[model samples]
Target: MTVSIWQSNLPPLREVDFLIVGAGLVGCTAAYFAAQAGRQVVITDALDVALGASSRNAGFMISSVDVYYHHAIAKYGHDVTREIWHLAKRSQALWYEFINRAGGTVKFQRTGSLLLAESEAEAEDLAQAADAMLADDLNIIHHKTDPLKRGYFAAIEQPDDGAVQPFELVHAIRQQSGVSVIPNNELYHITQHDDKFVTAYTRMFIFKARQVLLCTNAYSPRLHPYFINKVVPTRAQCLVTEPLVAPVLNTCGYSDYGYMYYRMTFDNRLLIGGGRKQNIALENDTTEDRVTDPVQQVLDNYLKRHFPDVTVPVSRRWAGIMGFTPDSLPLVGVLPDMPDVGFAVGFTGHGLSLGAGTAERAVNMMLHGTHPGALDAKRLEPAV
Candidate 1:
């Protein structure tokens, strides 16, 4: 099956220099940057624009390594871990630039982030992590004692952390000229032909371009068979509560390291997500918006225990899929052994913060054949 804009009777190809797959954060940002370079670009997605993790996430643009600096140093070495932290900081800066340029009602907030430790041992670990980051001159402040009236043991406030409305930002990027967006376009296969890449889709059209950038995230497994094992798709459940009078959570909060996370929106609605580890096996597959009873119960209990005074009704509950690589880092670089193919996926639930920068790196690599300094390609290289 071949899917092309012109061949499918949708719209003319218009001689695009780049054909980017998946109109989520990565694809849309890639299109914006590619088009900014005065290169004609076409972006397509399997579902509606911003329908994937790009829109389905809690919108936390946290500026920290996947694993804390202390843990990362112990696991991957000091030099590599420091490099990772630098990359994350650079990514955070790029996100601000993106939001400023897009200039939409994207609801970007730099309210910072809080990392709470649920237990004594975890508190010590978190303290060590904070100390490690501080030693490196990072602005992570530690509150040794529990600050919340409800007793969250230890916490670290990351001053540079922030949030953004992913959907609005992606839509704003799409409005840029020279970028053609094709929704409901699914890529099924890719073939190389005389210095160009032709993407065939199950929807019966063929797209030919000088290069194809795969930014499908978890959904990439279906198009690239090898990704099935390399990138594991996991389902995350989240719920939004009805507006509350006073904002209870001032900053985005995450506990148990990266396991459970929640944030308060401008409307005072609490958006909570995580706990896929409870049913890890079941959650490790592709699925639609199905919320598990146990997961919902856990989230409800957390809210009740933490915010006893606030009475907010549960307005909506939903599930989103995120991709996770074995190393718990994003995969951002040219696909090994494939020509003119680049990708930015496997964000491991941290796409909102790093998506734009990674996509920009992928676009730069595709255009100039060199990895951008902002992206730590060495750290994200395929383990195999």
Candidate 2:
């Protein structure tokens, strides 16, 4: 059964030209774009805006994949990897445009991102990664000394990376005209109608639309059974420390290929998350607010090891679920059997950086039957 919780005290559902399930970053932005096209659109979610991974995320706008481009090239070929990199760059630009147009203070910070290497071998790998990215024209530089002055690991800084308040951006986009967002409304079933899609929710209301898009991420399996096996849920634990007198991290930092990431909020607070692989089983669920002791312990040790002098008290601690596919790339395209239905999910925790571009490409595919070079249809195709 689905649940319906409206953000604003609004009336019941109504027919529209497009119905988007999961009003996260991707869905809400897609709604705004579609609505601006003079299409009547209704966006629904099981929770309030940004309540899912979109809101719970650390808000880092990365311009690379989970793995480095060299690694991706090795696994998926250079042509495919180059296309992905280009998509990320375009997505980063779109994020800036949205933030500027919304006039929302999403704390857009373009301080760049640093990937640290804890060992010599890791440092060598980082160098290779930087070289590959440079060859592809990405603005990534490999540095030996720690830029944050926190002697943790050798780093590679990507100057194009930035961060934003995910929830604020989502809300701002929702405020646009022609886009109606219904929160706490869960979509259970989607059926095809004549030139339209029928979406059934547990609220006993059926929504009619010319098209439907699924952007549910980790919890997507519930709405589409095929995604259950294709997309796996992974939990990421995050905690924010009270505003420090002198922020230790001026730029976002990631180590171990994003298993551990920490960044300084605009308010001078340290926001850190990851360490899911430590408690893989416990982190393999869809629940949004479960913080395990082991996960927290790893975070604590990381803090102590990295910032030995900083004595910042933890302000907030929470957990968010991110979707993972067999490969790390996201699935963004039309489903095989469902022509009127399209989707963008399984971001593997990289959605914060890549979601906007993915959404734009997905929307383009739905409207014009073509996607940007960044999105690989084969990678996004439903598993056979």
Candidate 3:
């Protein structure tokens, strides 16, 4: 968010109540919650609304974090894992409400999701994950073999998950939030003058805000030094084929231990993403949202190997930046020196799965002084 001295000299200092940085899905949701809390909210973004990962995702509203169920338990502990799953559930519900409130303008489908395994080892992992999920009565089906007959090893089906039009969903939320938006405004710096107000310097205007919440996600590290190591920006690429004669997949299909994901669009196009496992060096720790040949080649080979019937040409290819946290979970807390500035970030590529609920919690924590608990940034603190 580098701004030259000439560009940095904004017109005037604007006073805004509950200023939200970033106008993606989480930012819009934060605005909605803040407005609901009886505050005059204004959202500003570095780019246009929903122009980032929110618009570029496959739009799967799958529950849970980036990892598999039992794997999350091993990494974050059983209680924390359960809490995050509930958070995802809450996020999906919020999205449903937004979709319903849109009066059929937003495209959505209850297509569910299939977490498939590409190898025998992954199959065993899926079995274990299914056992843990079933023990908790999480309403999922465990298939001992590939149900899709797509040459996969095993699968775990989450009946509650769904797909959506990501870009339209953000617009719906923004309209429902009924807040003013300042697009193309990048926040370069933020300073809390006192407990009453925080001043933010942006490309457009210097804002004297009552409270500030950052939904910047992958761009968070660039905004403040506190997020330097906390959020690693990773690039994810995807390609969608032309509309097929018939729909190939009815559900979001995730395989290769969650590295690969594919789903059929509402218009009958096959969208495939995730080759980062094969090209980790090129894909990880970068904010550059441009598809490369290596990753695209992997996706191409995958399509050939799996969905051999799909002969349509590739329609479009794109990339999106995802904020990957050290623990593969979202971070919700205030900055160390600026208590008036709060942030909800680091979704680890599961922004659609957890953004709304995390934003709701972030707004509550910022405005009402409620604790975010497991989602708190304190969880990342080093042991003394």
Candidate 4:
């Protein structure tokens, strides 16, 4: 006796000034701002709240860019890298402001995080990166000491890093958006109609909007060819251990330039996720959510190597899909030729902290006709 979403209670011909896809942090935040700016808005999701990337993440408001400072500098050059990092910190600030407006009860805390270098060469690179960040007036410390080094050569602490309950963050943002949320209603296909986008998701969705924002992240390419093969849908697996008395990790962090990362929950449980590179072939796909044994084995070994004394049982194991760009930036712009539609996808796993501010900028780009500054519009354009 289950009713299809098409048969669910919905208007046959609903209209909105703005229709946003995806209900994750980015989408929700975008909807919040768009509605605040007086746009009749509605948000749709493929699944229930907190079931997608927004829920299945390490729950961190990590301060730095997904591509570390040194790695990003190597690719995008020093000045551009510095700009990206500064924008990343700005994104974190917007997120904090949003959370505070909602009474700051999202388990949000400014717990500084560390990036551990595995070798002396890597340690040197970390120190140089730290120096560059300091020159940019960003707070960071490079420690050569092994006190908090869990089998690493050295670590750099980013004092502005923080953690939050991903579910709570989205939930809090939804409260303010006032946008109609329609979950379990996936946007299968969308078409341009009379200068408005007509979306089909369970019987035409009865939705028409002057503009549509594709915040679908890993699922972006599936809806529009503009992002095909550019915004790569990557898989990341994670596991949470049973609550322990006291965990060594009190903050959110990553290692080896974000190939692996771990963070502690407020209840003193360690949640470690990553290692997609271990099975590069298997992890590079568009839509696969099943947890593989090989990746799980790698995570188990990571825990044993780092937290030897913690014999706590694993509470659960799961996987989430994230997007990565050919270059380490998200697609944040209106369609090159089609100006009526816009998007802000491909966060590369840093969207947890960067999504809110990124969405705000994207909203401005759409409504106010201003170009996005935090992200590069030229580099993120559809692959020609």
Give Cα-based local distance difference scores for all models.
Answer: 0.76, 0.77, 0.92, 0.79
Best-performing candidate as measured by lDDT: 3
Query: Where does candidate 2 clash, by residue pair?
Result: 5-183, 5-184
The root-mean-square deviation over C-alpha atoms between each candidate and the true structure, in angstroms, is 3.2, 3.8, 1.6, 3.6
* Number of backbone-clashing residue pairs for each candidate, in the order shown: 7, 2, 0, 0
lDDT of 4 by residue, 1-384 (tens): 233666554647667778898888899999999999998888888885557899888877777766557666777887777767766777788778778988856778788888887678878888887777777777888888544657878888888888888889888888878776788888766666455454444444656677888889998888778787678898899998999988777767877667778888888888888777788898886578879998898889889988787799999999989998877577788765566778999888878756877898899999998878747556755387
Candidate 3: C-alpha lDDT? 0.92
lDDT: the better of candidates 2 and 3: 3
The digit string of per-residue lDDT tens for model 3 on 62-98 reads: 9966788888888888999999989999999999999
Worst 10 residues of 2 by lDDT: 1-10
Q: Which stretches of candidate 1 lie over 4 Å from their true place?
A: 1-15, 176-178, 202-204, 372-384
Error of 2 at 252 (Å): 0.9
Query: What's the best-to-worst order under TM-score?
Result: 3, 4, 2, 1
Let me know the TM-score candidate 3 reaches against the reference structure.
0.97
Q: Write the per-residue lDDT of candidate 1 for residues 283-378, one digit (tens) a residue.
A: 886655578888888788777866676686899998888888877767766655567778778888877766776777788888888765524445
Candidate with best TM-score: 3
Residues 1-384, candidate 2: write the lDDT tens digits.
333465222335557677888888888878777776667777878877778888888888887776866888998899878777777787788788888887656668887888988667777888889888778777778787656666645788888788788888777767753577777777776666454555444343567667888889888787767686678888889888889998776688688777889888778888878877687887885655688899998888888888777697889888888888877788876666677888888888888677888888888877788864545546655488
Query: Which clashing pairs does model 4 show?
Result: none
